[model samples]
Target chain A: MAPQGPRRGPVRDGAGRAGRPRPGSRRCAVTQRLAPRWLEAETFDCRDAFVETLVALASEDPRIVGVVNDSVGSSKLDAFRTAFPDRLVNVGIAEQDMVGMAAGLAGGGRIPFVSGAACFLTARAMEQIKVDAAYSRNNLKLCGMSPGVAYGELGPTHHSIEDVAWLRALDQLVVVVPADPVETAAAIRWAAAYEGPVFVRVSRTPVPQVHPADHTFTPGRATVLHEGDDVTLVSNGTVLWRALAAAEQLAAEGIGARVLSMASVSPLDTAAVVQAARETGALVTAEESVPRGGLGGAVAEAVVAHHPVPVRMLGVDAFAPTGSAGYLLDRYGMSPEGIARAARELLHRRRS
Target chain B: MPSTLSHAHLTLTRAPRPPAGAPRDEVVAQLRETARQIRLQDLALVHFAGAGHIGGDFSAVDVLTVLYGAVLDVAPDRVDDPERDRFVLSKGHVAGSYYVTLAAYGFLPVEQLATFLKPLSTLGGHPNRLHVPGVEASTGPLGHGLPIAVGQALAARLDSSPRQTYVLTGDGEMQEGSNWEAMMSASHYGLDNLTVVVDRNGLQQGASTEASMDLAPLADKARAFGFAVSEVDGHDHGALLDLLGSRERPGGRPRFVIAHTHKGHPISFMSDQVAWHHKVPDADQYATARAELDALAPAAGGAL
Candidate 1:
């Protein structure tokens, strides 16, 4: 349900604008680029990088197998099925059975990557994911493809906005949301090598490359995309680049905003969040999810527990009207300029 | 674990096993005696713990004894072997029976039955594979174990291992949609190394299964779902040994065995009784059931 008050704060027309260069910001000094590399023209789907990395990892490890609930095409696993036909166990359209079978396969010493639509895979068989995989400590990988509101106009039933909240609550499950193609590939590879249950959100919406090609993912580590001291913008998933853009815009206006890409949601990088809270004294969280229980909720929890700050959260707070993914995101105040506006408001609140 | 043996440990020890290469009749006799002793121990567990699914436990005892005694190739030492046969108790409300059965097979220490259902005990109301040594999966909820078993079967096939996978479900539990989903994939993959046994005890928690949801013609339903279906007397140790131990997978499909059993089987007052599904017997009822089991044979208390 959407709140009745001015929960969205103020609207700024320039917020939806894609990219604005910050040549005078600390990002330019750190990465040796005039603007953040994520502002480039080309955008890439994280699913492509997911499948490519999976195939490369599967070639070296025979224990790696793909389990799908009839999502070979939707999960972009056609090449994986072709290459490893027998290894790909397609339990057609049964999410419960698919997750249980993945645990069973892991019990028999085969690593199973269960891929399906983020909505059905997380909600439909949540009990199986909890008891069989997380509670039992089964070495399984659950790839939630097209996570968050990436389904766009397909309706909220198909949107997995609550997946991070649901999965991170499980005891032994590792929840991860990769920001871009390079990070997605690295997270998949890292999950494959880790000896435990992992739920990695693979986004279908296109995003520009955020990390360098040589980036290696470490669990529970947050990347500081832009160095600033006025306010911290903690974001992940498809909304990460937008947060970076918001920081660039804030930098152009002489208000430094620190951008932290918090990909690991469960074993959250609380140290980085605490550092940001103590240094900046104000924080704003943005995600491609509900405003209350996803990334925004996580950062708020970490901040209040370790170092309290004036935290502002931005996300899809209600069932969106019929619109494209970009439109819905902008309407929900997750656009770059909208995030900058929220940060400015939070900064003003702290000043007063 | 607690060391003091409660009354639940009355005459608890390893169940008698048939000698290696024993004749069919001898094996059947030993299995029957073991089942009777396991029933006695299971009864004590419920009576002492003051709670259990005693009805389902009694109905599943004969089948469980037959598996551990003669059918399965599992051993306490080889619990972690990847190629070992896998057994999952899908009807996990009967953890009392499962725990005693594991104890009787030396998979767990016999004295540990004292801690069953106790506070901070490893043996909770349901089987947790993490806590128990021989348990393959921690299953409590209905319709969960079969899918896990099916996946295990698929993994064995992928590895080209001859290890067989088995799961036991309560007849009432068949109404859950997940079991049907698993059956579809098990049949679709032609998983010949899998066996699914249903404790067709005709009773759910509150009513007869037929009145709750008719599973009449269950064999036909399983057949439609791609299993080679058969029916047997669940308590008949001889028959259970033959059908479940049969390596033959006709048509190269998964096997579904419907063991026609009565809830709270063999005990006159409890047999086929709906109220006894999870009822804890009082002192008088407990004494009567214990006497009924002990009189079955002279060596009914963990002796052959």
Candidate 2:
């Protein structure tokens, strides 16, 4: 099946979380009236896009299979289980088994997408993912559901802020953080066709569409969302839209902030990051994860290695307090105003 | 499974053929000789390399000999056969015996055993499927192979293929909860094509399995997990062949054979000794061990 275009629809509760506010029905207080056009557009749960694309791909390819650790309702694989009952193997609540089994499935000439909550999936089965999938070069695709603090108020135990830092260290695994529903579908389709190890961080956080209707995912490539010359705001996943909104805010304040949606974290788009640093002179990175060893660390590693430029990273620093996902993101200086402030600080530090 | 045959690109120069259609007594005799040859080669490799789990290697060689020598439908020339029977050595510390067994079966050159743990050698402390053909999974960490074998069995069932998937895990490795999780999955799916053979040597690194984690009711545990459990003398080639070859999976459940074995089998000093788990034998010990292994088949030493 050819990849399908973006579907603009209501948040279908792919995560089965009740009482989630509809996109555009409620807006963050910091950017309430100043929300950009993209922020006001209809939003979607990327998990829905993930499953939709996975089902479509499975329909065409008999080799594609789904392996989960009893995360059917949470990972939104109920439809996939219904469609291909035998293809979906649920190793009940066993993350290590789930990943190892996926590697085995790949060894048996099946493309297995192992899905689970990012917290247990990465931390629990990390050795399996490292040995079976990465070092062994098994063609396994790992889908980390509800990554990067998407499970808010559930405490730090459930937060997946350390996933990127943990997974990007593996050599052969391609870690991708798709920005929106369209990009999520595109990444799934790409992973299905690609014949190697891949780890795609799929978020359940409802966010407005950031990519276009025909967005295509390329591994290790960045999509330049906004053009500027003064500074660059590099981000992806749920934080990319906020970075875009921050760029718009910076533009209003006579600051040219280029926004680069860096979805691939492992095989990072170092070329784009180097170009952004060379052209803009200063860069600010925002993510829904920790700045250290996450996107910020990756960007800083690239910039310091390739281009010598001052970079300000925006992300959660400490274990979060009690709050919702949006509140945690804002409290950690990830809001549009906060991101713009980070860029301004970079500029000021450079001037001083 | 794709018919395009995507395998690790290797220039394997396999030795010529011998058919396995011999009678029962002759087949068992051949398996014993094969085990003896592998043990002798593995003993020398471990002694020369100065590092290897000789205990576990010796414990697993008979089972490995039975599988590759007589049971499994894998061939050195057809390593990429999708319908071929799959075998995963989960207790990967004994890669010495594994590599020797593969070489004995002509998967690779028998002379390559000299490069067991040399610098830049493909033969690492653990078996890697990328560099070695006929290795189904690259396993070193405990509790990994069962789940992978479960996945392979699940894939076979999904394809509606008649291929069998087998995994050999250490009795001590049964302490890993992941093994139990995989057993649950295997039994839940009723994967009759999957067979799990536990190397029930009753020993681990620093202590016995019972003293470490107590898997005493191991067969009962597997039975409760919905497996058709069977206990066999691991070194008895005739019993291992009968149990592993044509055993029935009662009620279409998965097979879990508990192969009772000693830490170092048929070796006087090292047998059932915990200190020999990974201990490199000194010159005196090596001579004695080599001489003892040599007596198993006096004329077979020149085969490799």
- Model 2, C-alpha of A289: deviation from truth (Å): 1.0
Residue B116, model 2, lDDT: 82
The DockQ value obtained for model 2 is 0.72
Assess each model's interface with DockQ, reporting 2 decimals per model.
0.81, 0.72
- TM-score of the second chain, each candidate in turn, equals 0.95, 0.92
Tell me the spans in candidate 1 whose CA falls farther than 4 Å from its real position: A1-39, B1-8, B299-304
C-alpha lDDT score of every prediction, in listed order: 0.86, 0.86
lDDT of 2 by residue, B1-304 (tens): 2211122212222322336566898787778877877777777777777899999999999999888887888999889999899999999999989998898888877767667898998998999999988999999999999999999998898889988999999999999999998888899988999999999999999999989989979888899999999999999989999988884656669999999999888889999999999998777887798778777773755221
- Clashing residue pairs, candidate 1? A15-A337
Model 1 per-residue lDDT tens digits across residues A23-60:
34322212222253433445666788888889889999
Q: Write the residue-wise lDDT of candidate 1 on B1-304 in tens digits.
A: 1233375356766866677779998888888888888888888888888889999999999999999999887999999999899999999999999998999999988888888899999989999998999999888888999999999999999999999999999999999899999999999999989999999999999899999999888999999998999999999988999999787777679999999998898999999999999899888898899888877875544232
Residue B174 Cα positional deviation in candidate 2, in Å, after optimal superposition = 0.5
